[model samples]
Target: MLMLTLLGWLGGYLITTQLIFPPPPPPGDLFEVPDIRGGGLASARERLTGAGLVLGEIDSLLHPSVPEALIIGQSPLPGQVLRPESQVRVTVSLGPQLRSVPDVSGLAEDRAQIVLESSGFLVSVDTARADLPRGRVLEVFPRPDAILPLPARIRMVVSTGPALVAMPLVLGLDREEALILLDSVGLIVSEITEVFRFGRDQGVVVEQEPASDIELERGAKVRLKVGMSGRATEQ
Candidate 1:
């Protein structure tokens, strides 16, 4: 009778333990998703596998701050309960979008600035003395057709026409000295007239067409009359 009672008690204990209080599921069957954003693609894949999850479809897009091939986004956000071997979709970065600098040379300054700004570039203008018309774009830094990341700063050189300067006094000076003085002031001597004069005035500049203190564009031509002991000659 005691043996029968012992056997019945053991049977009841087994049923309660097996049915009433079932054991927890195996650790491998569930997982809490891990955060893999900002990690490299290869490393993210390894991380997902280690967490009992698998990498799913990968999409890529141009991201300004995120580096190329790095994970920028993921589905099944971190700390979510997921079944083992569940797939996690990710979006990878292709880095900042590259842009080709457009040809803005010869365009007006305002137009060039608009074009650059429209193309996702920052614009800065610098005035320079050029042969082109005033306010025209002479050139651009990084040159045309150069490729760079978006939002890059571009420096444009715009024409203010030719530079102007006051003509220097060359009268009564030696011809060579007069030439040097004119050159120093950004003036070019285009014509020279040789005139017969007294011995004291020989080899000296007697007159200049534009006179002194006249404002003229840089590289503007000036006519000079020089004294000579020989017969007067035109050159």
Candidate 2:
């Protein structure tokens, strides 16, 4: 009877010991951290999860050489033993830092574009006719000395040179002569209609469209009315 009792006690002791304290895990059972630097946050998290590990707190900072949201560094680097309940901490990049817009007014288009791009800005060009020479920057949006985020798009207004020209008089002249006169001043003949008048000779221009010396755009069209003799019979 005593032998049976002692056997029961030994079995109970073994069961209690196992319940109280677990055996240490084998070395190979631990997770080895993977190199995740330069990888995106989503991918890093996936990699950690795949290795039987958890992702820890993340830190962010501006980094010129690293892309945004990518892992720039990590705590407990790759190949380290990852404890079962431990997490991998990472530092992520937030891309280039912010900077102010420089004074690019009066600079040529190509030079301005290069300057802004080098300063980490995107560039857009708009053109307007101004007294400034063609291809010269007339204005910069957001203005100079304005604080802006990195890679901000800057729209520059460039000059397209002068646009206005004076209209020339071409009245009482032959049709071919009128065409030649208009062509010399960058103007085109839009229409040539005939009008009958007592004093004017046939095929001569009696009136001009935009009469003389009026400011207009170069290449504007001018209409003319030629004189037709009243004595002429209809065909």
| lDDT winner | 1
Per-residue lDDT, model 1, residue 156, is 96
TM-scores, each model vs. reference: 0.59, 0.43
Q: Backbone collision count in every prediction? A: 0, 0
Can you tell me which runs of candidate 1 are displaced by over 4 Å?
1-30, 166-235
lDDT over C-alpha atoms for residue 85 of model 2: 57
- Candidate 2 Cα misplacement greater than 4 A, ranges: 1-25, 28-81, 84-89, 92-96, 170-235
Considering only N, C-alpha and C atoms within 3 Å, which residue pairs clash in candidate 1?
Answer: none
Point out the worst 10-residue segment of candidate 2 by lDDT.
226-235
Q: Write the per-residue lDDT of candidate 2 for residues 37-144, one digit (tens) a residue.
A: 999989998889898888899999998667788899999999999667579999999987878888988889999989989988888999999767789998888898
TM-score of 1: 0.59
Worst 10 residues of 1 by lDDT: 226-235
> How far is 4's C-alpha from truth in model 1 (Å)?
37
